[model samples]
Target: MSDTLLKPHPLDEATYLRSLGPGRLAGRTSAAYWNMAGPFGGTTAAILLRAVMEHPDRRGRPVAQTVNFCAAVAEGEFEVLVRLVRDGRSTQHWLVELVQGDVVAATASTVTGPSRETWSHRPGAPPPMPPSQALAPLPTEGRNAWLGRYEFRFERGEPIPGRASAEAPAPALSRAWVRDAPPRPLDYVALAALADTFVVKILQVRGDIPPVATVSMTTYFLADEAEMARQGEDYLLCTADARAFKHGFNDQTAELWSAGGELLAVSNQVVWFKG
Candidate 1:
């Protein structure tokens, strides 16, 4: 009957945290967002951000977060250790770590601060793309469990069906309409996860799913809570691209845009792939 007892959506359930003590919270992995090896890295990042959001000392909204995947997180209980690094008049900084027993599985640095009214401009525009309704949703029934958690309609790059033998590599770019499968209103938490949903750029460029892991990912939230809520359940025009792949590492950058063309978030990551 209390708000605390309400059952959250699958995405929220995956990222849900329960206060344990000062600066600590408990959570568990969910089957809904399972990836090839572990829970989706995005969910991991979201939960870390959630810890900070729920912290008593938190201020403002999420400005940015950098999640570093230290090791594979096994499905089970985990503890998040949240440290309030500093709280300034306008900005709050935090350090968070996800611990599985004795080992730290992931760590994050986050910034939360109020957005002030100011002159703003973005030079780049959301790339042109057909309406989300114009394309068929990517099939997800038999793919990774996490794939079913979202709806993806590609306007430009879709992952190759399988390995490709083309002598030339495809351009490492994809533009698509993306949103939660069950249609949750946009929020910083949802935006954080959506920012990670771009099919890893290596799959888009090389046409093969290799043994890959995102070692580090950083997301910058541009839209404030009111702006995100105004998006309702509309799909975000999301895009991802890679600059280079060499020496077993690849660089990827992505942008998420609201249906009305507001830039919601920007993300970049370093991926390690094995042939």
Candidate 2:
């Protein structure tokens, strides 16, 4: 990715109509851009949110998003269309569709809102780990890669370097700091996308082969800019847990924190893997 900062504009009817042309996926094929698993649900959400955030009208704000994967997107040209469902003073709703040759590969709905006081709560923050402890760098080389578009530093158990790992006991807990390319300040939407990074740590803990892939993820924002910015760096401490299991599925929960141990967001993702 380029070091240039990206400022997105709102998706008006005119821009949406013109965006029907070929879309770029980090300079790669849109389909293969984020095929972490066979399904690109989380990737779809990331792309859609990035596009929506670029919109001139709703560039900086908290947004709630839900996406449904309809079909697999293969490598090639594609387009995204955004529709304004409702635009209110405090909140706005948008619908986005990913299309390839007239095929609807994926779709998403997002809601953006300003901070308002309805209720509040303070929960105990996750235990801290010294940043000076043995930390593993993210694997960025070879095929079947792990961390691609993000930079990370493990604060706990050693992450199996490269794409392959010798089967061993999975750790009960792990912590890591995550950030995107160029390490600029990211908004809530981008933070939500980064929250999914813990899925790798969770699967590693479970000793699951082929690494489990996320089916769905939901994140709740818990802090304001002043709180987030106070962390010093755009980095966030992510801690994950694989608490329960059933017929071929597992539940994982992760919390995002600032370097000062301030909780910024919490996330839960349903993951499944093939034997």
Candidate 3:
């Protein structure tokens, strides 16, 4: 069966992820969607963050969030519990856990704070990305169901999962322009998903796909709601690369930038993979 037959519009999926009450939320999986194993990690993180955002006591926007995948999340009727760990005048911290039948499938911690002018500097420059019109859309035929849900135009190091590289996996990187299919408005929620959407970079290092799981991940938002709204459905530039891989584990770092060159977010993750 094709994913198109089972997947609903992304916005509908996002709305359904909203919390039912204070620190309480629920969700079901789509039969049509699958990522190497269970549901997508990005969506799981977004749903956990949504729980905190829906909390009646929630304050400020999300400045940073860290999610730990304790175990695989089984689809259908999952519950998320969010707690206000700390509430301060300028910042709020929250803890969330997604439980499936008494098993703590995943947990997340978030820091939300008011926006203030501070000494700002971006020491790194954005990668030289080609105009959206200049690159061709990455084909999604015969791939994971989730790949069909986003638009990607790769500049280098495209996801050739399950295939061996010409030589060795020297340049473990993937740079592209990406956005949701049917184009959803950019938001912290959506941005959270984008952070983990790329295929595991370690696959590039090993020259083939192996058993892999993202053990932990953290994302830092540099822009607020206003910045997300300004971009509408436009595609954003993204670059992901692995720094080291050894002992069945690897660390990867990624950068996301607006088409206009504004640094949007930076993300890092640790994944367990078979050597």
Q: Using lDDT, give the best candidate's number.
A: 1
Give lDDT tens digits, candidate 3, residues 182-249. 77778888888889988888666556777889999999988877778877789989999888888888
Per-candidate TM vs. native?
0.95, 0.72, 0.91
| Cα RMSD for candidates in order | 2.4, 5.8, 3.6
Better of 1 and 2 by TM-score: 1
Clashing residue pairs in candidate 3, if any? none
Q: In candidate 2, which residue ranges exceed 4 Å CA deviation?
A: 1-43, 56-60, 117-120, 132-134, 143-146, 157-172, 206-208, 228-233
Query: Which 10 consecutive positions of candidate 3 have the poorest summed lDDT?
Result: 161-170
In candidate 2, residue 106 scores what lDDT? 67
| C-alpha lDDT values of all predictions | 0.90, 0.60, 0.83
Clashes of 3: 0
Root-mean-square deviation of candidate 2: 5.8
TM-score of candidate 3 against the unseen true structure: 0.91
**Which sections of candidate 3 miss by over 4 Å?**
1-8, 18-21, 162-167
Q: List the residue pairs that clash in candidate 2.
A: 8-54, 9-54, 9-55, 9-56, 10-55, 10-56
- Residue 139 accuracy (lDDT) in model 2: 70
